[model samples]
Target: MTLHAIRDCIHAKKVWDLCVPKRWRKHFFLTQDVKEWVRKNITIKGRLEDFEWRQWFPIICHNIWLAHNDRVFQGSLPSHQDTLVQSRACLAWSSLVLHVSNTVAMPCWEPPDEGKVKFNVDGSLDVTQNLRGCSGLARNHESMVLCGFLYRMPSGSILSTEIWSILWALKVAWDRGFRNLEIEGDCVVAVNVVIEGVGEEHPDLCVVQEAQMMLKQDWRVNLLV
Candidate 1:
């Protein structure tokens, strides 16, 4: 349901809070109560293109359902750490999907110079789940597939997946007896990281560093774009 429609559901019986016993709150457990519950109507105002609500509401609901299921089936309530991990995973997936859908597309894959393979990597976050997949394909100048691979990763930001795609593609090319290669991706931020061999201080720094280190390995003058 749209967030506006959920106002009644959030306020009437506080279905979200039904499971949290008063004793739990007496201990001052932090709660996710529809993000600012009040007696007045929620405006739900934002920029037309902004997707904050769509991205965040699902995380809250997913965590709540997960906690419920764990308590019911496993006879165990999720810890704060568990809730944070699940919620972050969901948030990462949402961010990835929004970035991919909004990414501008190239007309079609272009062939690189002869003797050099064009490695194109694309990443898409699974919209309905906390998973991300990246596809990397190496094609010769004749549009022949030298090698290709897809890697499924746990929930993370799109930049991390993009960086991983590059790393995996490089390994695939080296294994397939290709040396000269041109790596390409739609994410300018990720591409720049490969070219500069560095990334800003962020959670994705580890993967970015790995990809850069892989680039230093003997690969016969690979180009990043």
Candidate 2:
């Protein structure tokens, strides 16, 4: 039983016991079929409060396989303590790389689900020229442009332009009876302010509040940053 030797053996079992949460251990170790077990553990969603099972699954399996190889070929293998340290190091490095890739990558545009429209908006500012504006378009699931708006502001912060764009887009959509919308913008601050609400002392409080109020109307709006 290669799977048993790699996973259920004394040394490997000790490592898994320390790494996997007790509450999830039953479901984690339930499957005995090799393919099903591998698929189940690797693709399992959600995580422990402080741990990530998705990353841990492969790391633990690789370490155990390495130890099994060492015992068979070299007649020597590191103690469970050494194996645990190596697994931790690998886990930390893997998590760091995952974080960096997620942060640096720009995801491709995905069409909205059926029966919904996606509104993509962006704001631009030229501080040197004292110019700012915002533009947005609504697209159907087929990527057909349904409606759009463009506005130029003589003077205002970039955040103001972004918030204004959202407000106007929502108003137009609501007027046209567009109830299901997924709004996207590159300005993280503006999106967060509208979705999470802003403080009274915030500079763009009024406009952000207006946008928030529109979102709370009898409509379904999703804000994506």
Candidate 3:
């Protein structure tokens, strides 16, 4: 999963996970300009899983260039409103494709079965602050809180946090004999991996395998989000 891209310009933008400087924004360059810059700029690459959102990068850049050209040569025929309307349509389609190919649907929190317990788990890693924490709480169908705990985990990749949080929660539930369990987490990838079971070649194989072994108990477990 080698995902590579060259970031040039879109003006200084503060977006999720990035803070682009003012002088580095795009210059309304043509495809050739983009291509040339990509060739010259550093090649940024990452695993396909982690960098999946980048699949939309080229298309987004193309649209930006088209909008620039239309404003300069077409006399802004498709005004800002028109541009936004078209963009929304394109975005909806792209989002669907992205979801189907490599993503999972986000889930909303809900209660478990009548006799079962719902375990809500979450992990956070503040890279800038070097803080990492994981927490889990159990609730019953009647909206009664049962047990919960918060623990500090080592700072690492998002996968680490996701795996650790759920893994810890599972252990707690198992020890307490909370057999019929519904586990929920915001990390869909981690949720799916735990639900479907992990493979030998996976990066977090050891921890995931341990979690899988734990899931084989006499309890019925379900994972979401």
* The candidate that achieves the highest lDDT relative to the unseen native structure: 2
User: Best-fitting candidate, measured by TM-score?
Assistant: 2
Q: After superposition, how far is residue 105 of candidate 2 from its true place, in Å?
A: 8.5
TM-score of candidate 1 relative to the true fold? 0.50
Which runs of model 3 end up more than 4 angstroms from their true locations? 1-109, 197-203
Could you estimate the TM-score for every candidate? Answer: 0.50, 0.51, 0.50
Of candidates 3 and 2, the better by TM-score: 2
Q: Which ten residues in a row have the lowest lDDT in candidate 1?
A: 39-48
Total backbone collisions for each predicted model? 0, 0, 4
Residue 210 in candidate 1, Cα distance off native in Å: 1.9
Candidates' lDDT values, in order? 0.59, 0.75, 0.59
1-225 per-residue lDDT for model 3 (tens digits): 001122333321112113222334353222345455444333433222223333434433444445555555877533333233233324433443466467666544478879999887776677887877666767789855555555666656777778877888788789767989988877998877776777677777887888888888888988877
